[model samples]
Structure formats: C-alpha cells, structure tokens
Target: MKERTIFQKFIHTLVDILVLLSLAWFIVYSFFSLYRVSGHSMEPALSTGDTVLIDELSYRFIKPKRMDIVLFQRADKSYNMKRIVGLPGETVIIQNGRIYINGELLETTKISPIALPGLAKNPVELGKDEYFLIGDNTDSSEDSRFQNIGNVHFAQIRGRVWFRLLPLRKMKLIV
Candidate 1:
C-alpha cells in the first residue's frame, strides 16, 4: 500500500508540471513572435539576418512612442520594420537634408541626413491614428516619405520589437 501511494503522488506531481508547462507554452506562443531583419535599411541598428523577438501584447495596453522599433504591415500586406519618427497630429517635413517637426528642427542620435525627402518635401500631416515611420538608415529606407507607404495606421502595426535573439554573440535588448 505504501509503495502504491508513493507512485500515485509522483504521477500527480507529473501531471501538475505538465499542466503548468502547457499553460506557459500557450502564453508565450500567443504573446510573442519572431522577426528576422531582411535589409540594410535599418543598418547600424538592426542588421540583415538578425533575429528579434517582438512583444505583441504591450501595444494593446499602451500607445507606441517615438524611436520605438516596430513591425508593421504595408498596404500590400507585406511586413516591414522601422522606427517611429512622427506621431499622430504632427506635421513632418524634410528640408535641407534635415527633418523638421512643427517648424522646428528635430534632433536625434545616429540618424543620417535625408538624401531624398520624397513626399515629405512638403509638410506631411498625420491623422489621429497615423504614425510616420522611418528606417534608421534614412537614405536607404522606403518609408512614409513615399506615397505608397505614406502613413502607417495604428491597426496595421503588428508589434514592438524589444529583443535581439539570433547570432548569439550579439544577443541583447533592442533599445
């Protein structure tokens, strides 16, 4: 009887562990996604072939902030990664190879001069649900400056990229 009771306890413990693990797997699978960087547009920040983990839950509770690297779907239903530059209700214009927000020069770190202002040569106004995104490598990026990708709607954003996971040695939190 003693031996049978011990085996039953062990089995119960095993079932509890399995249940906990299953719950954990479900949460991670639903709330996180992996994205692989594909081009030089985000160079000097995220390189091609670098894998990153995206948090799909945070944006549901809070709005995305400027400088946040995000994964959003384009009009053609393709995904692209970029940094948030201009937010809702703001006017953005690129002139003299510099970016101006609300008639003031925008200051940022590590951003290169714009070679082509594209549609932003004229002031581009953002709506309440719109966001202007740009790649870190301005000259090489096809972003809000172009008509096709003019402004990203909040609903089109997939998630915020927060961690770099691949190329083991370079693994770190994406700021």
Candidate 2:
C-alpha cells in the first residue's frame, strides 16, 4: 500500500493531457488535416459530405507539380479541392479537348479522368508562384477555365490532397 501525494497526481494528470493534446496538434497541423467536402464542384473525385485529410508536409521538401491533387482556400474563404493542371511560371491553354502547357500539349492520361475539355484560349501564361487548377468534373466545376478560379495563387494553397478518409470503401489515397 503506497500513498500518492495530491500534488504528484495532479502533475501526472496534467502531463498526460498535455501529451495527448500535443500529439493531436502535430497530426492536424503537419502530416494530415481534416476538411469537409463543401460542394459537388469536384464530383466523381470528391463529393459533398466527405471528410478528407490533406498532407501538409509533402510539399515542404518537394514543390507541387502538375496533376497533383491539392487543397486551397478560395477568395470566399471556402476550401476547394482540385487537381493541379499547370505549374508556376508555365503557360496553360485548353483548346479542343486538349491542354497545352508552355506551348506543348499536356498529356491527358496523367489526369485522373481522361478527356479534359480544353478552354478556348490556349497557352495562358502563369505568373511567378501562380498555378492553374481544375476540377475533374469540368462542366460543373468553376476552375481555371473561368476567370474567377482560373489562377490559384501559391499563397492560397494549404496543401496537397493525400487521401480520402471517409465513406468506408471509397477511402484511399488520391493517387
């Protein structure tokens, strides 16, 4: 029968709580983040009511590239999930169901769903730290094709989409 001091028990409890909270904060801020899918603008790839975890650390070492799924905050303060179609300082043009970046036809096979409808203007130039993103479901999506979401500033991006963690069987890495 050993006796424990009240001060010691309080310290132990406080330490336990702090440890758990620290771990949670690290997990949420660094490696993974939880986001609620807001609209069907990204349907087929993602839908409403889906909770996803974006990997915030990957881009820390490696810069994001074309065709990588990403999560970013819009001008309206809402987060949108989409795939990157053009990189910084590159030209992006969508014409006749084809995408041209830097005057070269971008391979459509790299995109998640084949057959991307190109925009009327081909070879739109990108500014420094600017990237062009688009939703897989282009027809219903307001993406780079439109003036509003056409260019995503590098500062607005939160991180790359790592995986979908909800809806059971549908859960998997975005690829």
Candidate 3:
C-alpha cells in the first residue's frame, strides 16, 4: 500500500470534480441530441441518413404547433420523426389525400412528392395533452392517420427538429 502526499491528494480531488462535471454535461447534452433518419418516412424534406438537431428545450417555453417537425418515441422503442398536423383540442380529418383540421384545409409546405393514401374514415380529436403527427411521405408513412400511432401525448415528444446537418448540398433548416 502507498501513502499519498498532500499534493497528490489535492490533485486526486480536482480530477474527481472534473470527471463529475464532464459526466453531468454529457448527460444533459445527450437529451438535446442530433438524431439521424434511417427510413423514408420523411422523404423530400428529410431523406434517409440525414442528421437532424433536435431542440429539446423549445417545448419548455411553448407548445408544439401544426406543421412543426417533431421527434417522439415510438411504441417499438425507436424514435419517430414526424410533422404535427393537429394540436391539442383540435379535430383532424384526412380525406381524399388532403388534410383537414377543424373541417378546413391545412396550410403547409411539408408534404412529399407523393399524395397521401387518404386517412382514417373518422375524424380524430386530440385530447388536452395529445398531438397528431404524420410523416411527409404520407402515402407510405404510418403516422397519426394510422390506428397504431394516432395521438401522441406530450410526454412522448422529445423535441422539434432544428435543422439538418448532413449531405452538405441538401443541408438546410427544417422548413
């Protein structure tokens, strides 16, 4: 066994503090992370393998709005990147490949090249803490229009997409 000198003891304490601080920082930063797209759910706007920076802090100040791209947890334990189509307390209807909110057409430019395959027959009304989401690739995406992923509660949302940071030529803020 070796006895530590006073100087060595001081250095050990300093190292311990530094390590703790670094760990805390890493944990906080990971919560606001850059997630990479793996599927074609958000094509035209976000292609496969595109990395997006998620701003987890924005929801802290304001609620997510319609057409805002969001990141949420899926039932299968994977993260889903989708666009908000209906907010809390709103009625959403998808008919004839068009989206209608509160019986009026939605105004947004996030749709993919393909037209949606029509939505569920009934209108979906979001609850106080629920949000309706859908992918840009409406024709193929299984989102809020589907029975499995209809309305996402606030707690399941991670954050809004800030911007894309890969494939330089296509890099741009999430519009």
Q: Cα lDDT of all candidates, in order?
A: 0.92, 0.78, 0.82
Residue 81 miss distance in model 1 (angstroms): 0.3
Q: How close is candidate 3 to the true structure, as a TM-score?
A: 0.77
Please give the distance, in angstroms, between residue 68's alpha carbon in candidate 3 and its true position after superposition: 0.7
Backbone clashes in model 1, listed as residue pairs = none
Considering every candidate listed, which one attains the maximal lDDT?
Answer: 1
**What are the per-residue Cα lDDT tens digits for candidate 2 across 5-90?**
87788889999999999998988776888887877767777888887888888777888888888898888898788889888888
Winning candidate number (TM-score): 1
Per-model TM-score, in order, reads: 0.85, 0.75, 0.77
Give lDDT for model 2: 0.78
Better of 1 and 3 by lDDT: 1
Runs off by more than 4 Å, candidate 3: 1-31, 112-119
- The TM-score of predicted model 1 comes to 0.85
Candidate 1 vs candidate 2: the lDDT winner is 1
